[model samples]
Target: NAGVTQTPKFRILKIGQSMTLQCTQDMNHNYMYWYRQDPGMGLKLIYYSVGAGITDKGEVPNGYNVSRSTTEDFPLRLELAAPSQTSVYFCASSYHGGGYNEQFFGPGTRLTVL
Candidate 1:
């Protein structure tokens, strides 16, 4: 089953630029999240959406934003990117909600800022 998929497996950007981390799921799941994974570190949740029309910020939401208008698409937007945002971003989804622990993650989108 196709769980989650992210685009631009690798990328390089300049300072003050922006990009969107695309996230899509074919399972028709209801929960989705966008997280940034730094070198040798656990994934840090940036933003998440419980369902369409419902979104919220996570642990680290600074410089990032998101909108959930559909169950299958939850994209992460970075406005005014910085070097600090040059990390591997991952998109994930789950079939359940309310603190569900089983989350399926995409390969990742590695971004590098120069």
Candidate 2:
């Protein structure tokens, strides 16, 4: 059922450019999240949404924005991208919040800013 899907598996962007990473899940999950992983660091949450029309910023939301207008779609927007923003972004979804439920992650989108 396409648990989760992300477009443009890989991207190369010039510094100061903007882009949008698309994420969609067909599982009807109640929780959706956006995370970024640096070369040698753990995943850091950028944004999350508990449900449609309910969104919140996460640990690292400085250069990004997210919107969850529907349960199945959560898109991340990156404005004025910088080299530090170059990382593999992952989109995940779960039926429940917290650690109670297993989150299904989509194949990450590798972004490179030069």
Candidate 3:
């Protein structure tokens, strides 16, 4: 099973454009998360979902949105993309929401908004 998968390994979007980053997990994880990593910086959570039908914004949710309709998929939407949103985005999933479980990370999507 593909633990986690993300589409478009790399992208370059013009400012004001919009895009959706797709994420899917075959492990049936209960918790899924979206995070962004900037150059020389640690990752910052953008959104998370504990389960299907339940989603929440994370530390950096501005200009971003997420939806979780099934245990296997969580997609992130970027609206009016800006240069500030340029970063490497990663999608991760875990069986537990806390530290008890290990999170499996997908090969990140590198996005650059010019």
Candidate 4:
């Protein structure tokens, strides 16, 4: 529980399945984010929250949901998985929101859908 950590390093899902990607940080960061990276592409923000109970959608929120019930936990839920959702999901956290601050990233969860 030093930095951001993601559970289930890898997963495979059939069409229409569902799962939750768990993320946790022990640094007490106020800002948390969920991002997905497609093959050969940069990270696309899926959701973010400034603190507990303050969640918002990011650049790509379709088919995904997130909730922040505590300062250290942020989970991303995938409903009705699809082929388009196949990618590596990353969780990040920052003490502050700005270009000057550093964001810690989790190892990522590799999800494959068919």
Candidates in order, TM-scores: namely 0.94, 0.98, 0.98, 0.97
Kindly provide the TM-score of model 2 when superposed on the true structure, using C-alpha atoms.
Answer: 0.98
lDDT of 4 by residue, 1-114 (tens): 579999989999999999999999999999999999998899999999999999999999999999999999999999999999999999999999877889899999999999
The CA lDDT at 62 in model 2 is 97
48-96 in candidate 1: lDDT tens per residue? 8889999998999999999988899998888888898989999999888
Task: List the RMSD of every prediction in angstroms.
Answer: 1.2, 0.6, 0.6, 0.8
The list of candidate 4 runs beyond 4 A from truth reads none
Better of 1 and 4 by TM-score: 4
Of 1 and 2, the candidate ahead on TM-score is 2
Writing each residue's lDDT as its tens digit, candidate 2 over 8-76 gives 899999999999999999999999999999978999999999999999999999989888889999999
Per-residue error (Å), model 2, residue 28: 0.4
Off-target runs (Cα >4 Å) in candidate 1 are 98-101
Relative to the true structure, candidate 1 reaches a TM of 0.94
C-alpha lDDT (0 to 100) for residue 98 of candidate 1: 64
List candidate 3 segments past 4 Å from native.
Answer: none
How displaced is residue 113 in candidate 2, in Å?
0.5
Root-mean-square deviation of candidate 4: 0.8
